[model samples]
Target: MKVLHFLSFFGLIASLSLEAAPKKENRKPNLIKPSETSQTSIENSFPKPKDQYQIRLIMENDAFGGFSDQYYTNGSRLEFNMKAGESNPTRRVLGYWNDLFITPTQSTKYLQGFSLGQEFYTPTNIEKADVSYGDRPYASRAYFGNSLTTATEDTSITTELELGMIGPSVGGKSAQMNFHNFIGSPTPQGWDTQIPNSYSGALRTDVRKFYHRFFGTQYNLNLGNIQADASFGLIFRFGNVDKTPGPGSSALQPGPPILHEDGTGYWYFYVNPGGTFQFYNATIQGLMGSDKSYKTQNRNTAFSNWDNYLNNPTQEAGEREIQYRALAEDNGKNSLQRYILFNEFLVNGTSNPYNIGLNYLLFNNIFNGAEDIEKSTRLFLLNNLAEQWDQIPDNARALAIYSIFRPEGGKLPPQIRLYSYEVLSQFILDPKQREVLLQLLRNEIEFRDEKTYVADLKRAVGFIKVGFVSVSNAGFLFGVHYNYQTIDFQSGKGLPQQHQWLGFQLGKVF
Candidate 1:
């Protein structure tokens, strides 16, 4: 009996000891997978500590606007950026502050931020006589957004809304003419029947002034070794004109052209050198966007603004006189006259021209950012900048390519066997051209050990991104990435335990 009692006492003690021991929590901190980022992706898998702040000084060349090196070479951007409030990408409740400056084209003298949204610039150099007929200030030169991985590690899709010059003109400057009319559209019987419109007998004199509004959206996608980008947008024009024609009419013009934006206005027409026109100095208002009809009170005054050399037997001119032959069956209506002049302008090749389109996906990049993998290729479509991609002079395109690919010290890697420096250096190029080349070289020179050269290439084409992950629970560690280029375990390397050995790294957080 005494032996049994002792055994019972010992068992109770053992049970108490087992119950006293601590329990291991079921939750484990998330760790970063190798495939989520190139060399620069956050190393930690768990969410970063809350309320952390990050500031970065950004000096980039010609990559943010689009993938092409030629898109923004006219100016280099220098931005002082700061992000505050929450640091979680899943719930990015943060505010941004930035002081972005650009030289030459569209320069900003003040600091900017998320609170500021965007700022606009007006034409201040109006004193210059040749300031270009439609030279106005613009606010859409630069764009800013999250530089971190907003989506889960395996895939990411980022969309950006932008305005102003969406991308660079391939060969030269492009022009679009916007006409804003203040008068209403012609009556059902047409302006001929309306004896006395506001500018009576003035002929298609509804146009008062001209101004334009443009908006664009760009989308970037990252899927393992492939990255794709595309953009689309609309251009709008608003005038003081009402639907009806004739004196003192406040209603907008009633016509064939489809009105938009709550039926307030419509897109006039897209113009290029090769485009055709049926009339000049004529009122274009019909169901279709391009309705060519002539109604002019003074023809000579209209042609006077233009060069006299254009006057010829076929396309002649007179003082406030109709140049083209008048239409028949007029009801003694001196109020309106219709003339036709089939014409198209011969654009000068030497002069820089522009091509405007409703949408564009001309360029994108696809590459594997894995340190050990081979580099991917760049993709180009037949139509970039909404124009024939091949139309750009080979020399010009060569210069652009050189600017993007030339390595550090302006040196081509010895491994590259094509095109010697002597032959490639012949064409004159912009100074900003070399900056991108330098960035591309930096990847080969600095990050080769990290195996992030492909990521560098993505960044060279204007994919800006940055992320942070903790380094072994000490503190947070982070690095900014220009573009998204990361490998995935399921595809590239498979499960890490198979190829990548477990290892321990000792480091302090920044």
Candidate 2:
């Protein structure tokens, strides 16, 4: 009964947090500071336009952090003082202008305001050290009246790489190569894989749309070791016009437009029923705009398919069975959080990366009795990938479900038996293609125990064996061979509470 109630609770939590709610967007007063309204009309306030220069300073604070900027209006150029490292007095000078020299001509309407001022090229000095000079990697933008603008920016961080020259092979000095290898096991505790992060830089282009249902699109060309990917997504509002803005809406005023990590925004004004927005984030908004959820929603959708689904196909028996082989898993990593995923790398690719890969195996887990076959294979993968080469204990079973191909595998109690593997097999494609897909079933093929070694040197070299224990009226149910097996929690030992490890034990306790 305790296990039953716990399973029910786990199911409830998954349903609640994974669902998405409708979102809307629009422009608010924050974009154009209310106080800055006076400056827009300053030219007209005076009788004759004399030689008067304008100097403006702004300061802002928010949850993430704060920034201060100073702007001067003159052909002579502008200077900027940034207070990023606030705790310390060592502030940095971001830019210095040589009289707005690099700005486009005055008549470039719609985009005339955008320019990389001369000051942008000056070296960035921090802590009396010059990290970057006159290299304004930051892009420029110009606002066009009527809720539109165009901008381009490069948000790339470069990493220096030093490779080795051809080694000493003057006359065949014995061919030998040195390489570093990193592998991890996935436990319920978390990602056991130790992934080293890399520096990333990207070129961004954008177009802003800000009227109703604020929309935009952005394209990032990330350089360096980071993964390359192109993704499109959006956040739209759906509600009665009279309803307040977003989560921060008030009773008296219309809801506020959606906001991004940065104060900048690409927003739609008022959106009522019958309103719809389907576009790119880079379209109307500048490169840096608000659309955090867009990326996450896409990631979530991918996560939805990461696990195995109990799919029982209604196909007749004796039909051709499919096989999938990962000639080699492109375990490379990339920048965009989404790019790190396998599906994203495949689905978002212009050319199929999976067209030719390296994985070796025969047969797909699609047959009528595939459940038994897969359950058998799953234990092997789990044991081989574990800290100690043995089957997962009853208590750590939730952690065992971290690998792919099991939907009902999430942190569930071991009383369960998988019902379907068909739903998952459809994803692998044709029968021949399914061959060599042993990575999912045969993950531990590279490993073996003493019994396996003594059985048959060649054939048994690549197979792994695991154990299982379950509790019933018989005190305990134990199985020596690899199959859908179980172990009891609370009791530190395997089933029977005597010997839980495989290879050494044979037959069942019952």
Candidate 3:
């Protein structure tokens, strides 16, 4: 019944998004032309001046949508855009980077943009003082971005680089708390468990092609620790639209300046429907190879027993039994302890071949070192491994295992290999024996054929934006948009699957 309700809601939104705008002939024609008026003139009596520079301030807040404060809560950006030329520092820097991928043509006009932005996310139950393991983590990202765009009449290509910091230093906690106090909302309690501070950088490239005045397609590729995904989508526009170099709106990001040839006003409604192939999202899954400790357990003592067991092999069976019992006592107290126990059980006493396959699968796929493999595939494989593990042939497993650990080349991180060595070193005692055991474990990872695992993280996202751009004869510009987006990720229990926000922009042409 709940699924049906969501489906119905999405259907209604789609209908509204695709509604055609009223025809121009249906509207009353303006009889007077004013030199300066609050509203824009449909027709310009004189030639419009070319804009050389633009500065814009953009703000987005979910509170405007009247939704709960969870997930993507708030964001803001300040942007400056200018014509790209040899004298521009941003153009000179990004131009060199762009040349590596695409050579600019003579007809291509270049525009450079620089921006500073901050965005933050929260879990469903913000009032909870403890971490919510099943929900998305609390995260904040503040970045400075520089981008270069090359455009013609029908198409545009943009390459952007963003460098920033993620975590408490970004002031997400203070910002949210202060705002909540101002609005008389419940204070978020889980910010103490937010993702730790870390340096982050990402490269993003977008290509947009307009097939007709009102229709176009856009493709985007993003790579970095913060997000890794590829997306393709179609764009539809109606009402009074202009011939912009790229997508008319930057959505949430900073965009190139709009070129208004006649300094007149224009307004449009647009719908963007798209699907993304997600690879990794550090904001949800945590950073790769990060050693930061969380509030879940006592970091110093969480693995003391396991470490002791690995460091001492000559201990009596009775003594080993006592250590194992101690671990059992600590289990269920916290997430970290439970995880350790699970790994230990798989390593010491799991007789089922299927369970053995699962152990290797969890370690290899979850802690993947390869950059090309999709991180979401690990979740899919784990969910289905039980039903399919027995079907894999032994010889195939051998070949796969051999290929993964060829001695001369392996992609596993040094930290993971070292951790594995520490665990085995105690039992093997001898260096040579331990090396052989490590190789055997690596071979076990190939039990299921690599080709058998399929990625299942593709999700469709829907966007509806209704906005207007007005440029005064004096070169002033202002716009406001109401934006709505369907679920972008798989929401956890008791979480909203849709989000909406409002954006306001104020700019000037100099």
Best by TM-score: 3
Worst 10 residues of 3 by lDDT: 448-457
Evaluate residue 201 in candidate 1 and report its C-alpha lDDT on the 0 to 100 scale: 13
lDDT of 1 by residue, 22-84 (tens): 867885664855354323323342355442222222223223333322111122222221222
| Candidate order by decreasing lDDT | 3, 1, 2
- Provide backbone clash counts, one per model: 40, 60, 0
> What TM-score does each of the candidates earn?
0.19, 0.19, 0.55
Candidate 2 lDDT over residue span 66-111, tens digit each? 1111010011111111112223221111111111212323321111
Query: Which pairs, if any, clash in model 3?
Result: none
Q: How many backbone clashes does candidate 1 have?
A: 40
TM-score for candidate 2, residues paired by index: 0.19
Model 3 stretches astray by more than 4 angstroms: 1-51, 87-89, 96-107, 245-251, 262-265, 293-475, 486-491
Question: What's the lDDT for residue 478 in model 1?
Answer: 20
Which stretches of model 2 miss by more than 4 angstroms?
1-190, 193-221, 229-443, 447-510
Worst 10 residues of 2 by lDDT: 448-457
| 2 versus 3: better lDDT goes to | 3
Candidate 2 backbone overlaps, count: 60
The predicted structure with the larger lDDT, 1 or 3, is 3
Off by over 4 Å in 1: 1-53, 60-148, 151-154, 157-510
